[model samples]
Target: MTQTHIGVDISKDMLDIFDPRCGHRRIANTTAGIRRWLCGIGTDSFLVFEATSRCDKHLVAGAAAAKIPFVRINPLHGWHFAQSLNLPKTDRIDARMLARFGAERYPEPTLPADPARSDLAALSQRRDQLKRMETQEKNRLQDTSLAILQRDLRASLKALAVRITRIDALIRDHLRAHPQLAGQAKLLRSIPGIGPVTAVEMLAHLPQLGTVDRRSIASLGGLAPKARESGKFKGKRVLGPGRRHVRRCLYMAALAALRHPHLFGNAAARMRVAGKPGKVIVIAIARKIITIANAVLRDQTPFATA
Candidate 1:
């Protein structure tokens, strides 16, 4: 069978599809239509879609279930590609461009998380939302000197705290229900500064670490150092993108580990002697924590304090 590449331009009301060997087609962006079209494609074919707002959630899930190899490309990449090719501005034109783009360059496929992990992530996101809301409420109070709103705001903050507590409980319950995840959580907690909340967070963000090599997993987790260079201007290594969730937890872990006297105590002392700021040294500690976490997860072993 010929390897066929398909691209779909997603919009609220319609979907435009482009094929390299064949012409394009416009389909209703409904679930039934998406399923039928995806089901018609063979295993040797590939499907590419741009990540849009909420609607994309369905299209990607449908395509995955239909056994189509689906790739979610950064929309900006597609837009730049379109401009480079001098493609016109229209849904159909975008769709065709996507097809041609997919045929020429296929983006890496994303790994979909299990249902349990998905649920846990959702709860974690909700917890973030609550914290944001609490901050906003507090900021509003600070912005005004009105006493009437202050009382009401205090009540609201209390209610938000209660909701946050409930969400935390739900996250714990979900973790407890999965034995494999629960065991991983226990191992993560064994590390200094990795508490219950942070441990579960690492599990959610670094799930692939369990099956992959430590260095590769560390790079993917975004803890690996990136070299910086421009014609004649070379900069030192720096950390860039990785799972923000894991990175945040590592930031905290690094803080605790730096002062623990057993983890990075000597390294921290040398950095201080060299005039590196305490905070910067802590960040270096965080990077090391991420490396160690990758090793712990990949090897399924507890962190050795000694």
Candidate 2:
């Protein structure tokens, strides 16, 4: 059966829609408005929208509730698709472009995140935000020469640290309440250097960890290097885009893993012997760790050196 493609350009307060049949229109970004709009579409409709931080959450939830197929694409990918047509930038234009892009590309629709996983993801993201704020305050403290500013920064950092610790506790408690997540966390933590933070982040962010192949998992985490080439020229392989939060967590895990010879330290030593740069070796270890984690989860087994 042919599926109808609809593009929705979401903003903080408005949802600009472009349906190939109905043309352009605007609606509120509230749940009611989204549900109302979704009621008009059939189950065979394929809705496409760009990731607008938390703004599109309502749309996704509404689509899932209505049993309509939907796909959330990266904003960069949508922008590049728009560029192909050389059209003026506008909400309506972007929506129409996305509709065309979806029609042509026929991208696979993504399943809605489980309620438990979504809650965990929210907590994980909040923890990251607090940590970033704490780092920023600490950096400011190092640069400030005035005693008054220094005192204020120090107090702010202390408060942030306390809040971060509380959030960490909450994440642990939440994970414990969910047996499946807890089991996965335990499995992930079996590997050296894979701490609670990394394991929780993976469970919350990388849902495809165990289901997909190693290469796909690595690429999803943005660890896989992509080849760059032209007719007569070849460029260096570069890591393309993926989940930033998951990649950051894995990078930290990889760093810790390098300190333990039984973990990834031996692999790092070999890479060093091969004359790879420090950063390159770290990235390689990150890729390896993700692959190992994927395998461990897929096999439902703990990490074993053997």
Candidate 3:
């Protein structure tokens, strides 16, 4: 039996769609609009679209509710696909290319986004923004000698600090409300490196941590080192692009992990003995932290030293 694939180029307000049989068209990226579009296509078809931040929320909800299978890919992946085909960049072309990519690649359908997890993710993002603002204010405070500017910066820092505290409380309450999230967080926090913030961030952002393989989770977390080698010329392996925020969380966790001599300190000591760079050691520890987190969640158990 022939399967239908539709590619969608999503913007904040509009969704550009392309189907092999139906050709190309545009629709409002709203609940009703997505519903009408999905209705026309039926359930047997596959919907392929990029993960355009919150813009794809309605589309994802619509597709999941309609029992339509979908694969939400990173924009970079789609761009690389276009480059491979030497295709021009346009909304219509993107939609068409997505359809073609779906038909040929046969990527698995992504799991539906849970509303509870979505709420947690939103909270986590807001907290991250607040922290960045706090950092900026602190930096400005350090550089400024003017009394008036310093006062304003200090005020901003205080306000941001209060907001962060409130958000932290909200996150705690959210975890209490969601048992599964709470359980996963508990397991994550059992590790020496993972703190409350890191646990919540992982639960909120990287939902596939426990579900996927270790290498895949590492790649998603941007911890996987990519080899740059061609014939005899073997360049140094470097990390590839992934969730920057996730990497940041893991980096901090890795720093904390170094304080534990039994769990991670020994590993760091070994790397130092080998004359590895400090940055390399930290990144290596960060990678190990994420892999350990992955294994813990996958096994539904806590990290144990013994």
Evaluate residue 39 in candidate 1 and report its C-alpha lDDT on the 0 to 100 scale: 73
lDDT of 2: 0.91
Model 2 bad stretches (over 4 Å): none
TM-scores for every predicted model: 0.86, 0.95, 0.97
- Superposition error at 205 for model 3 (Å): 1.0
| Model 1, span 1-306: residue lDDT tens | 556778888988788888775778888888898888777666787777787866776677786687677777878889999999987889888888888888888566666657787677778778878988999999988887789999899999999999999998998788889888888888877777778878777777666766776666667566777889999999988876667777777778888776688668988998999999876787777767766776787788998877
The residue-level lDDT of candidate 1 at 236 comes to: 85
Most accurate candidate by TM-score: 3
Q: lDDT by residue for model 2 over 1-306, one digit each (tens)?
A: 999899999999999999988799999999999999889877878999998789998898999899899999989999888888888999998889989989999998988889999999999999999999988998899998999999999899989999999999999899889999999999999987799899999999999989999899999999999999999899989998998998999889888989986667778888899999998998999998899899999999999885
Candidate 2 at 295: error in angstroms?
1.2
- Among these predictions, the greatest lDDT belongs to 3
Ten consecutive residues with minimal summed lDDT in candidate 2? 260-269
Show model 3 residue runs off by greater than 4 Å.
none
Each prediction's whole-model lDDT (CA): 0.79, 0.91, 0.92
